[model samples]
Target: MTDLSARDIERANFAFSVYDFDGSGTVDAIYLGDLLRALNLNPTLAIVEKMGGTKKKNEKKLKIEDFLPIYSQVKKEKEVGSYEDFLECLKLYDKAEDGKMLSAELSHTLLSLGERLTDEECESILKECLDPEDEDGFVPYAPFLKRLIAGPPEEKPAEAK
Candidate 1:
């Protein structure tokens, strides 16, 4: 908790969501295998399975708390802050604890990012990506960020001669 910022907290939370692959609420070897592989930890499937059978009854199970230190280490090693850094920081919000982002959550966050967006523009962006008919009214964070990253850039008017 000392070194971990809100964004770091969000990143771990996102990974935790993915690690719960079976929707079992409790993670088994299968889930840990996938989680380890996603982070490129290089454990084989067989090893993963062995891990599943080895847990002690009185021991506590793995949680995001156990994962964050490794996540923190990885983040420190390769950090190159950019606009993505802002986005990384935005992970602290973005309804990201759920690993899905709501348009309403993003719109409020847009207002607070270093460069300001008018409420109109926030509403406009939401209209473009968020479907009014979707019952959950949320989008996956990766693609949602990709859409923003890959979309057209805003341009100011040309200067007068």
Candidate 2:
């Protein structure tokens, strides 16, 4: 197994804490879906279907594990979230002025993780996060934090034959 320094583990735990709504320790698909929903992305069966392959009539629900490939890909594409990085992200996404985030806010926050986002992209992201269904089109901070810290699954050890 890869050896992670204590700081790395702490950072990971902090990240997890930021999103783990129920305090389950790990962030799973349901939580992710909630996060997406809060962000106004509302990832549905359609989106999950697109993630894996052709959409099927009776497709198996994609769990957090299902996102492993995407997570790995995202980790590769983007740098890991650090303590300061997470704090900065909190500041950016705190649209409600409550020191937290709405799921919709995360789209831009995530985009900003690697590169600067254009005005058009930022506007599009806002559109996605603020649900039209809501009278104000804004999400509260408490719920947002719950979904953000949902951590990745348990680390696996190297194969031993």
Q: Compare the candidates by TM-score and give the number of the best one.
A: 1
Runs in model 2 with CA error above 4 Å?
1-79, 82-84, 93-96, 100-104, 115-134, 141-146, 152-161
Best by lDDT: 1
- Would you estimate the TM-scores of all the predictions? 0.35, 0.26
Q: Lowest lDDT 10-mer window, candidate 1? A: 51-60
RMSD of candidates 1 onward, in order: 18.1, 15.4
lDDT of 1 by residue, 1-161 (tens): 53778875775577677766556454443356556555544443345444442234324346566556545554454332345764576577655476566656677777875556898887777666444434776655555566655444558899999
Predicted candidate 2 versus true structure: per-residue lDDT over 34-123, tens digit per residue: 433333232344443444533332233333334344333333333334445556557766665765455555655656645557768656
lDDT of 2 at 79: 31
lDDT of 2: 0.46
